[model samples]
Target: MVEGYAVGIDLGTTNSAIAAVTGDEPEIIPNSDGDRTTPSVVMIDENDETVVGQPAANQAVSKAARTVQHIKRHMGDDDYAVEIDDEQYRPEQVSALILSRLLADAEAYLGRDVDSAVITVPAYFGDAERQATRSAGEIAGIDVEHVMTEPTAACLAYGLQETGDADTSESHEKRHVFVYDLGGGTFDATLVEIDLEHNHIEVKNTDGNRRLGGEDWTQRIVDHLAEIAKEEGDVEIAGDPEQEQRLYDAAVRAKHDLSSREQTEVTVPYLGPNYNLETTLTRETLQELTADLLDQTIDEVDELFERSEHAIEEVDEVLLIGGATRMAQVQETVESYFGMEPLRSINPDEAVALGAATQAELMSASGDTTADDVLPGEEEDLLLVDVTPQPIGIELHDGDFAPVVEQDEKVPISRSDDRFTTVMDDQTGVRFPIYQGQAEEAEDNTKLGEMVLSGIPKAPAGEPTLEINFEVQSDGTLEASATHFESGESVDTTIESGVRLSEKEIEQMREALPTLKDRAVAGAEQKEA
Candidate 1:
């Protein structure tokens, strides 16, 4: 029975968790380590053995160069890698290790295999990043059934939690809801219309940066500590990787501590006695240091509202969903900007995972477990509609970018027969370089992938016309098909350049997983012993 069921995975930037629908309620599935959430960290020991989660995080303090953290920010960068023991590991490969651990935990909790999952990503994740996420799932041996936006998932969790107390007979009108999510490594803001009566949740628009999050705030604290250490202690420790790692860990602890206290001390002991980097960081100081990052999120939210043609006054409620949103300043800023108090009913860290479980339950509902049957008028039957965060296009003559799918376009969208022609006389081939961004010049946009239409009948300029079609699925996956009108020849392929790994690379990682996992288990056992 569990084999056919699907679990929900929050494949987050800093932490990951899994959950599944039990009899009637969705429950978070704790990892094998008995933790509700696992730190998204991966480390390679000096022996070239692999370790993930908390163990990996512990290793990072001592061996910063060998440990990988916040790899999600580099998901779409094909050239980025963490060098370990003279071997390179891509972001997807590292993320796969995290996913593998989560999957193992899910299987343990469910008492059967959990091969299918609905993973959540930041709403603003572009095509390449989403593809890389899927690739990571594949490498982890999971059949990623659907990729849900983080804010949308949060909405589902909120609606589901609120439904039992609402009037089922009344037709509740749709309300425009806003979600401000700031996790450890990414931030996303989304506007959605949720109609409980009609069982519909439609996302209007989403905007955010993958690089901005709590980690940036922590870095601000770390920098402050380094400055104080140099000026007061006269120790130039910031330049050293090992000392920097200790400072980073200490700063993160202090940041979390300051959230509940007026002030916290950041201390990293030096090798010698009487020489350590120690400083008391106040909440006010923390706020001042990271005000610009906070403003950046506010600016993004304002832009989202403007682009969606929605006003701050029109927003019925703003839901905060992320561990970083716990910051008092973040809460106050968002509340003042939106003119409303952000909802904090659900646990920010667990809401996304819980909502993912709800979606997975919807996807795997059987004869006796239909979503409509469970809750009479709940989000179980709610339809989710996502939008593309940026324009998707191909390069044109004179280096202009011709857009096939514009930003804010509702997805699982398909645009067929977008026509283009050859620019030169006797042209035999045409290269369609795909890009995603608002820039007019193709060179200015982020190039995702490209396809070549060759063997076209040699013709004069503008004689050969090709109809290129683009399909962006609900999960933000992109696929293209091109047809030559003269010969009716067509070709189709996925965008593969930036983040999506090749089949051979995926296979290689797949083959390496068992060894990596075995070594990790052995290392854990050794530590326990």
Candidate 2:
């Protein structure tokens, strides 16, 4: 049976969008309330109703505490959270709300259930964040046809231009391309080689910064204005909640305007009945503030270029993804870095989702009913070769981390390393901290979770040969299994700390959304925040 209405979703840190291929053409479906792009904001109503998109983002300023945005960045980490009226909410639950809203919006437009969808994520996102995204999709009732890399997905959208060509055979047999993606909230550079022979796309080398993006640049501009406000009057705008919102709102406007204009002045609204204060900021000043951030992105992009083994000019296309690419400064920086005009053909907002939809079409057409699709030449046995975005390892005897799985290792793969017992007559459960990133020390990488292996049989320190095996599935989920070489005893489990909040946490946040919302619901809120 043909998969009905394959959908592609770009579940972004700042904004999210859903699109689908219409028969042979791609089309973005309007959200339930009749809008094209949906804000990646989630809010709760006074009646315990969960809301998403602009509505939730609107609350971000007022509720400031409850409405969660950029939760995508905190995926896999346990420390990040949103507390409302003294109750704590997990990032997973927050992301789940966003997914739910997307589903409701898509279904509302199509008049059908959207069970299967291909979601796009940052190529740099580790096992934890990728897994979190999957769980969010699951909770939102998505079948999660596949989780395609954002850059790879963008390539799918761009590669369509070469389709239906007479020379497609030569182009399909192992073509090389570089995907440089500088988006809002994250940056990813990947080397992708398309093998039409196997009808597969492989990511060669990946490099990026999780905390760097357009928002980081935008916030830096906001900081400059705050400084200007301080020096002009030794006054604090952020300290005053009312003035802070207006100032930020104006700053965003100025940032967008500067994308085309050389300089734009921002005037903030005056607070209090006296209405005595006014502030101005310029585009040049904004660039000055984010110079360092821009440099960092370029450095990483250069590193990826070196690893991809392709020169800057050799890049087939420089596809820009994310809303932040609208800034002229970002566009200019990219042009200078690659020595070419970046392709703005793909809607920074819709490109990822379109690529995602195209992947779903491929997955469905492959004739595999399950999430894992049909392999070439064989029905329902696709071989996916994915790699660890960052090197994963544990700390050794000294401060340095020992690589269990080297960076960018292939999937459905495993390796075992022999380890000596840490202590004499140890009977306690062995806890191994799993981390992802490119740091010489384990502390440098993001600690995803702890894997605990129990009942070691109380062996002498020097007597046991512990064989630890690290395995990654086709879906990019990781699991570590350790066995006592002597007895062949083994243990396996997930690495998540109980940090995944209980159902009670979800209930309270949803319950409080409305009360907090009504107090601040003075304007039109986006249907999906």
**TM-score of every model versus the real structure:** 0.91, 0.84
Model 1 RMSD in Å is: 3.0
Q: Per-residue CA lDDT of candidate 1, range 248-356, in tens?
A: 8898899889888999876677722468766678999999999999999998988887777777788998899888999989999988988888887888999998988
Q: 14-71, model 2: which lDDT tens digit per residue?
A: 7888887665556778775567788777766545555577666666666554456677
Q: Which stretches of candidate 1 lie over 4 Å from their true place?
A: 1-5, 168-171, 271-273, 365-368, 373-381, 416-421, 426-428, 454-467, 481-498, 502-504, 514-529
Model 2 weakest 10-residue run by lDDT: 370-379
lDDT of 1: 0.82
lDDT (Cα atoms) of all candidates against the true structure: 0.82, 0.68
Top-TM-score structure, candidate number: 1
- Candidate 2, residue 468: the lDDT equals 72
